[model samples]
Target: MLKHAPSSAWFRSALPVLVAWFSLSAGACGLYSLPPLEEQKARILSDQITLRALTAQAFLEAWGEPTYSHSEPMQFFPVASGNYIPRFRVPLGESPPGWDDSIVSEQALFLGYADRGELLGFLEKRLIYREHLPAEQIHAIAAQWKREELFKTRLEAPPARPPSP
Candidate 1:
């Protein structure tokens, strides 16, 4: 007696099940796993060289839009002044007589990403500093942002009219 081979229809039905089983097993083996968000954030932050090189646009693409942003004005004296004097002063005859001790204002942008527990500072569109806060601090910052947003909305809303009699 001759044994009959499995029909094409049988193979077709089994193919999907086989594929799903393999997919699930691969996932269970961690082959498809991704690092935790916190770990990823830590890794990204640890790369200071890359972080410092990132421009504001690149940072926005990598970290997404910040929850809140603010501009800070920074002032600095370009020339030596006060108690801090230069050890070797420039020859008075060689250079201009008076020192140009003008206060220069720099525009810095502070981006706060509460969800990622990060605060990034950018000067002239270039990243200057980054801070990663703990979960508790992140939560507090998120709460403060929410409160500020609510207050801003309330202030911007039109005054309520008295109900008609």
Candidate 2:
């Protein structure tokens, strides 16, 4: 009969338990779990748009151009309304009609900006990032947009089809 060394015996006895313990710990910590398939889908669908580190080009590419753009007076002090320019008590509305006035611009479906041209954030009900989003859901949205575009094109074209030769 053959016998395992003491260290081998310890390893054989401890390995399975160690694996089980690690698995349980990870699962308990929310690092791993097999939730229902539908629940997984729901979780992905509910993930909100994260705007940090996103750029204007990326936003445009994802949403395929904003519906519109709105511009507002860029305040020297965006947080506080009272105008005080660097130790000078510059009262609000002192600047003549269009003097010293700057504009901050943004695009819609609810995206925000850091400055005139810098994109800062986003809001809900817009096209979510397909790569960041679940494949099934994003693909579905893309298909829906394609259908809408085709419908629009058909509406703009003449009704009769050109005769096929």
Candidate 3:
């Protein structure tokens, strides 16, 4: 014959409920992380990535195709177009060419880089935020980038033609 300790009896009774609660909580929090785009860019720059060597195929293999792909007319040089200027987390200086200059110092985070349909490099400028971004938030930011690009594309026009040369 065996006797249960009072505490042991209590723990046994509570174990299932606690386990269930923990399982639900963990699932609710989600189990995914997005790579920190800013940090990755820094690493690439620090490594002195040879942009010319990178190709669209290799880039796609590494990072996966961007959630969105689009181009914008070069504001300073209107004759130039067809470059795949990827969307960014933070807009670079004078980007969108006439937007307010506030927060222009924070460098843009390019999700992809290609020109004339060839990958030259990805990511445009350095980050202002030096702190380590939580990995989990990266997915969210990536999703946000997709959303922003889709919205912009739907709402904006193709780069305007240079005034009839």
How much is the lDDT of residue 59 in candidate 3? 38
> What's the candidate order when arranged by decreasing lDDT?
1, 3, 2
Worst 10 residues of 3 by lDDT: 73-82
Say which prediction, candidate 1 or candidate 2, comes out ahead on TM-score: 1
Tens digit of per-residue lDDT, candidate 1, span 1-165: 759988999999999999999985664233553444454445456653233345566556557788767653544222322111121123333432343554335655667777787766655564545657765665665566457556756555546899999
For model 1, the superposed segments whose C-alpha errors exceed 4 Å read 1-51, 75-105, 135-165
For model 3, what is the C-alpha lDDT against the true structure? 0.38
Which residues of candidate 2, in runs, are more than 4 Å off? 1-53, 58-132, 153-165
Q: How do all models score by TM-score?
A: 0.37, 0.21, 0.26
Query: Measured by TM-score, how close is model 1 to the native structure?
Result: 0.37
Off by over 4 Å in 3: 1-48, 62-134, 153-165
Report the backbone clash tally of model 2: 0
CA shift of 90, model 2, Å? 45
Candidates 1 and 3 compared: the better one by TM-score is: 1
Model 1, 77: alpha-carbon shift in Å?
13
Instruction: Estimate candidate 2's RMSD in Å.
Output: 20.6
lDDT of 2 at 153: 60
Q: Scored by CA lDDT, what does every candidate get?
A: 0.54, 0.36, 0.38
User: What lDDT score is found at residue 160 in candidate 3?
Assistant: 67
lDDT of 1 at 80: 28
Question: What tens digits encode model 3's per-residue C-alpha lDDT throughout 31-107?
Answer: 22323555444444464333222333333445566443433322221111212232343366535433332221212
